[model samples]
Target: MKFRSSLCLRRTAAALAALSIAGSAFAFADDDARRAILDLRETVKAIQADLSVSKNAQMQLMTEINRLKEQNRHLTGQVEELYNALEMEKRSTRDLFGSLDSRVEAFEPQTVVINGESVTVDPKEKQAFDEAVLHLQDRQYKQAENGFKRFAAEWPKSPYRPDALFWWGTAAFALEHYKTVISTQNQLLREYPKNPRAADAMLLVGSAQAASGNLKAARATFQKVQKTYPDSEAAVTAKARLASLGK
Candidate 1:
């Protein structure tokens, strides 16, 4: 009975030691779980911080992009404005040059055909010559005579001289300026014998002499016209005048 009591006490002491070891192990496991939880919480906090920094950077980048887009739009508008201004300047320059060229042309010489020949004449000179011819066409006899006289005096070497002289003689004849007609027509015949108006001029001189009662001189003049221009209209008129003088 004493051995049985001793064995039972020994088993009770061993059970107490095992229970103490199990308590110590459980305490160590709880400390490990707490450390693991703290590490996981720190990792999550670090990840959140990184995400915040990234979001801020992304927002700043978007702001910068928007600013750059606005700047580009402003630059584009300025470029378009410059292009339009350049185009307007070009057109203005072109128009100015066009007007200047036209003004310059007004003072420049122009080429014209006169009496089957090309001649270069000043604009002012052409205007004067045209005005004189217009006076003749209007049958303003005194004005025509004065205009032709001025044209002959001002442009003596002009190709239109022969026509001007002949018209002067015609105007003088219409005014019954017999001496003027005789002198003018004679001058034309002497200076431009081969002129297109030569036959007509000689016919006019012959008629003037007849009107002045110089039949002998008139007859000789008409005969000369018929001989000088046999196939001309002046020659036909001269023949009729000669027949009338003979009667």
Candidate 2:
């Protein structure tokens, strides 16, 4: 009976030691699990922070790109406006130059008709002739005579020669220069016989001769005029003059 009691006591002590070791192992495992859970939570928080920072950076970059695009569009519109303004200025300049050119051309000399014939006269020539004729119209006899003489000498081949000679003779007669009248009238008759002023020139010569006290010569000229231009107005005047001269 004592041996059985001793064996039962030894078995009880062994079971109590096994129970204490199992309790220590279970405590250590629980501490390890808590540490692992804490480490996982810290790692998740770091990952979330990194993602937020990346999102912010991406948004900033997108905003910058959009701003650059808007600025580019504004600059493009400004460039186009400048180009259009330049084009309009160029067109206006061209139009102004064209108008100026046309105005300049208008002052140039051109062909015109004189005495039923087409002729090209210089601008200066026309102006000078008109001024000389204006002097005659103003009864400036001396100036008309001098101007007509100069015109005859300078423009001998001009279509105005016949008219100039006729007016020169008339001016001379007005100034009582009978010798110059006769000479000028003779020149008109000799040079431009087919001119419409030829008969008038002959009549002027006869009148100048009569004024110069050459009655015989004057009567002969009047008779010649009546013979040469039988149906002309000068012939009728010559007939009246001859009748007055008692021839």
Candidate 3:
């Protein structure tokens, strides 16, 4: 009975020791689990910060790309306008004379009418004017404008003055310089009322005004054409334009 009791006490003590060891292990495991949870939370916060930064950068890059594309589109429009002006100038040169205009000074300013009597032109003025027409043909619009301006200044009272004004306005129109066209065409109407090309100039002036988004002014110019040159081609085109406005 004494031996059995001692053996029983030993087993009870072993069991208590095992329970204490298990309790300590459980405490350590809880501490480690809490630390792991804190680490994961910190890692999650860092990832969110990085994501915000990446999204902001992507939006900014997209905005820059859009801005660049708009600028590129604007530049392309300018290039196309220039090319069209050049082609129009070539057409003008071809239509004016089969031979190209010369650039020599002292060009005589005169009219070469298909139906009207020819006048004696200053050789220098004629050459300069011809050269200006050649520039129009080449699509050198600015140069053509300058050349025509020079011709107007040289022969302000010449019979061909109306014709020069017409060409000047035409060149400006080809360049999308509509305001200048209106000014030049008005000068043609007021200064050379009896000019053969006056009716045509008025029509073109109205067309320019229309193209520039001045609907009221264009209508006014067209009205003038209808009143003054009812039988002219310009009047016919003006009537067509007026009829199409409501559509």
Number of the top-ranking candidate, with TM-score as the measure: 1
Cα-based TM-score, every candidate: 0.58, 0.56, 0.53
Candidate 3: residue 128 Cα off by (Å) = 1.2
Q: How many clashing residue pairs appear in each of the predictions shown?
A: 0, 0, 13
Candidate 2 local lDDT, residue 207: 93
Query: How does each model score on lDDT?
Result: 0.91, 0.89, 0.85
lDDT of 2: 0.89
Could you give me the TM-score of model 2 versus the true structure? 0.56
Off by over 4 Å in 1: 1-102
Single out the weakest 10-residue window by summed lDDT for candidate 1: 123-132
lDDT of 1 by residue, 40-123 (tens): 999999999999999999999999999999999999999999999999999999999999998897899889997788989877
RMSD of each: 9.0, 13.2, 23.7
Order of quality (TM-score) = 1, 2, 3
